[model samples]
Target: MDRVFSFQASGVCINTQHHLDALCVYFSDRDQLDSLEFYSDLEASLKSAVLLPDCVVMIASRKFCEDIKEYWSNDVLKASFVTRGERSGKPFIKYYYLYCWETSGLVEVFSHCADADVKPCFNLSICDLVQQGLYHLVKENNVVQIAPVGHLFKHPSGTRNNIFIQARELAKTEPELCFVGRSISLAFGFERFAKLSVVYIDSMGIYHFVQEALSFCKVDARIHSFHSYDEMRKLTPPPIEHLIVISASTSGGMARDLRNDQGFSDSRILTLIDKSDSDRSGKVLIALESVDKNIFDFEADNFETEIELVGEHFSSKAKPPRAVTLGRPHTPPKLLKFLKEFGRDGLNSLNEIIDGQPKVLSLVTEKVSRNKVFLKWLEEEVSWNITVAIDTVICTDDLGSIEIANTVADLISTHKVGSARPTVCVYRNVDWSSVSNATGVLVVTAVARDGGLLREISRDLRENLNSEINCPRHYLTAVGLPQSKETWSRLKQFLERNASERLYGFSEWLVLPIGSDRQSNHWSDLAALAKTSQVVEVESSVVSKSVVDASLDLVSDAIRKGFNGFLPKTDGSDLALSSGFIYFGDVFKDDLESALHATSYLAIASALQKARDIDDVANQLRSTGYESVILSPECFLRFNDNILHACILRGCRKGELDYSSSPHHSKLMGEFLLKVFSRHQLPYGAAAVEFAAALATQRLKLKKNDQERLVGKVVNSLKDEPSALLGLLLMVDLPRVSMLSIK
Candidate 1:
């Protein structure tokens, strides 16, 4: 009775183009019966090669051993080796041999290996396989020194069997520090890796092990040690990303408790063994049974999207991030109007203020008009009161919310709304002790969807965590969705009934009306506007009739197809309040209409600003018969100086808006756009422009006989500017173009 099993080999360290070409040649020569395979990137190629069955892996670099170790599961008979050439003193490469057998052709594979020139390690206790032929490194009569590395491999019992057999040179520096903790560096973006919290549970030397691993990877992050679940929870915030729990001799109940009650996502928690005594025991089975489930079966995206590199040695430096546009991409009609009234020099001065230059609006625009427009809009839309005292401002840890909160804080300071500038803190990361004595709290979020997180914040602030807060002026600022409004109302009622009779404040200027099916007519109405709108007056430039018509048509088509840039959640909507950005889905259609209108411009610019690539929007538009959107005077000047000052302030503070590096800013841009689009009424500035236009149209119709005289009088009043004169003619001619030229 002999054992027979199907065999396969997977390899890493094949990171270069040369290695790929060599591996392809080697596999082809062996008659593995495969043509050239194509992959999108090197990471994709490496992943496919690692998963392929009946494959021969030629791993060349020890740097990639950490990646290969991730594939080591319970069913696989995995062996790690430290091998050196005959003339070399120290081991040059670390090899991991992982193979699982099915009762099909194990005998034939072993026979092939025996007849072959270089044998791979089949049983670590017996022999070591030299992976030298594929890349042609071996010469005549070269004997390689191969030693079994045992401590790295963990058994089910979590005990180290070869405690006395010490390979001191390799043990201290190579196996112990190179495998487990080094994975995180290549697994995620360097920015995330830098900030991640690494907590290891009840493992001796694991702290130093992880530190050394990170040092080897050329990165650093906060690392904490914990013994029990209670001890881990005392870390202020339990690990949201990485929790390393060491498996001891006996399978502990911690894994079960973490999965069931500790609110830890499976992908965030990783279990490791510090020492394994025997390699032949039921390691994988015991792990599966003891951990209650196979811990390795976590979310695939945790490994896929987060991995910045497959091999750290060959990875290139990330490109510099592009500038983020805080406002709409297209020029607004108001900016054109401003330029017509005041020249580019005046416009430049206004921009200087938005650019965070220490300039006053006294020279830019009339204080009376600017204050009247912006202050009225702010009071109506944001519910700002000069009299109400706000003790602290607690905002969701999102870029948009933070920006809005900071702006609101500035306004409070200007008006002296409180005794001092209220302390602004992010809710999730806020220190409870810092705000324990505060009596008033204002929760500001960009958008409130179902109010789940809001409820949590409310509970913690009002009842659970800080019950002594007694201020009646607690308020919330958000763009309330259909269900969120109801949830907030219920919460308010519950708080009022259970605690005090004081009225709570919630300001949502643009609460969208919910339909029978929980869908809002807001987007639908915008779609209708896109369909009927005949003219696209952008800047003071004359846009051709066909371009405007085609732009509108494409926008209508895209709306019918659903906002293609956004992916719907389980609720059948694109916006996810948790991430504060709409998930990037498909990009089949380009939003051309955004180029001509402020509202659409704001939406598309926000969408693209949050996009993974800034040029994606521009490229898509160009392919679809529209030019790439660019910032113009109207983008900021369309609104008053005050409005632009608040939104674009951070653009100056942080140097420039780089959404790629700061994903939080991208999320914030999405949130800001969500607030803009979700509004029931147009922004105050746009609404006023439309109102004035309608009034002028009505006056012209009334004085039919005196129309020529009235027009001449208007022309005489603005005789200095010819651009404004020509814009007036095109503005009135738009209706005629849609009727005659469109047909």
Candidate 2:
């Protein structure tokens, strides 16, 4: 009854290196040998061969020999085999079996058999033997089958015992594996060593399984259990970091839901199923196969292998992120400075202004011509380069006076030799316009001594030319008149007596006298006349091209300065109205062209002088209905002083003042009007009374009765004047008139 297993050589001697004693036994008809007897013989031979008591024995089995279980020892193992059975005409029945045994002596036996030269009687290799042993152990209920950490494992309810314990033991090396089952209750033994979080998505209503898992998984890991996906979705669960254990019955829906709804694309998932659900086409198998790797029938002992495979696979597939840059590396200092001064918007404006020609050229030209200081300052302090082309420079010869008819006829004959550029024909004391053939000529006539020159020039340009003139004709004038002491004394006396006399009419006849005292008296009289006259002109009586050129230089300088000031502040299209002087001359017609240019400096000087005596000027204007007129320095040079003065006075009386379309000029006129009204005394008339009353009401925000009383007082004050009766009639209301007995 004692069984023995024998290892014998089959006469196939193979030479091999060896360090231990080797024994081989020949076997004939090995299938007929008794299993227990063979095992006993093998053990005895192993002992005789000086092998350790730990020697192992292997048996090849052709069937599932249940009777051999009684004789099986720890030192005995079974190699796998296949047997076929034929029953009449029915299909053959095939059976496969494998088994293994392990003890303290197993390693010793393996070590002693390391270098045997004889071939073994069995046909199984070492790999075959190990696989067969593992297969047999998995088939038997002695060792529980465990799945890989991230895979589904199924077993019968009876065979679920010791599964968690084996998994915990495996977790010692590969900590990711933790087990939960109803039959086996094992606390998370890894709790003291490491912490983890387990999310059990229990769609199958496996509440008992969840409770058991939570209880057994006593590690620092937190176990969250939800019966349905909707319940789980209510709370924002942390990312599934450690593992997600789902029942195989619901694994497909759970996986799909987790991916589609919860955005769980990368969570490690484990599934649990029953042994009866082993159909490959089952939901559990399909779900497991759909994932990155299918981990089925995973043993706790292979936990490290499973984790390593998953770690390598995921690590290989991981992706990481990218980077960026900005702006220019370097900027020039000059460019930075420009940006700081003008800014990007301002620079664009400046570019536009430069592209458009400016409008204030003529006014600037006139202002520069009269002032010697401005002329000098322009030449030296303010650097300006200019080019001048003079077609003619007519001077007063020793002949005393030039005849208008002959001079024009001779100039016309000479100009017959036509030139490419336009001719600027200059003349003095002559009616140049009477010459009918003066086509393509820009005539600049000096009208200071010619009484009819201005009238004739106007007539010719307006009527005689027939629009044949290619360029505009202008009248040039000197800035101021010279005066002798005796003449200044006489003029001063005349002005003192007749304050409203047209002063510019006689200004040309006076000369600054030879003596220093006479010169002082001459200037004094001129200043006196300037303060008294409604309109006055001061001129140099020195008309020449040099003066014109100097005037132009100052004008250019003013324009440059104005542009420099405005460019940084404005967008090119619109500039400040106050700065209109910079482009004032560009808008002029030929009528005032020369006058405006010639008198610009003098007008500015006179304006400055009036500014200095602004209080006195304002008082005088307010007392009388008088406007302080500062004519251009050359105003008398081009037009008869008396006629010009009369025209201006008439314009003012009619409430007509021309600003030549210049805002700066318009502003100046407004300031003059304000000064004139600053302290105006009401005249004795209904209009004056009403004006006073309205002004008071407006200033004080007065009511009806208060305003009427004020008006009555004003009217009473003017009762002696002829217009006061009209004032009273206009002032009284019907009720008040009845009380006053006015008919």
Output the number of the TM-score-best candidate. Answer: 1
* Residue lDDT tens for model 1, 1-743: 11111112223322321111111111111111111121112223333432322223322123222333343331222222111111154322222233221111011112112112333433321101112221111111111111112111122223112111111121132322332233323333245445555655444434654564456445555666664446655443353555443423223344444555556654444443212223322121112222222322222222111212111011112322223233333222232222222222222221123223321111232221133333345454444442356767888766656766676676666666435777898888888887777766677765444455677787777643456556644545444333323454675564344356546666542232111112222233334444544346422123444544444444344344432222121122322111111111111124321121222222232233333122444321111111112222223333332223222321111213223233444344333322332231333222221211221222112122232333333323323333212223223325442232210
Error of 1 at 395 (Å): 0.8
Query: Model 2, which residues run further than 4 Å from truth?
Result: 1-195, 203-218, 239-242, 273-743
Model 2 vs. true fold: TM: 0.16
Worst 10 residues of 1 by lDDT: 20-29
**Stretches of model 1 off by over 4 angstroms after superposition:** 1-376, 379-387, 464-466, 483-498, 514-592, 595-743
Error of 2 at 600 (Å): 99
Q: What lDDT does model 1 reach?
A: 0.33
For all predicted structures, in order, the TM-scores are 0.22, 0.16
lDDT of 1 at 68: 32
Query: What is candidate 2's lDDT per residue for 11-70, written digit by digit as tens?
Result: 111233222211332122223455555455544655454333212334332221333443
Number of colliding residue pairs in each model = 10, 39
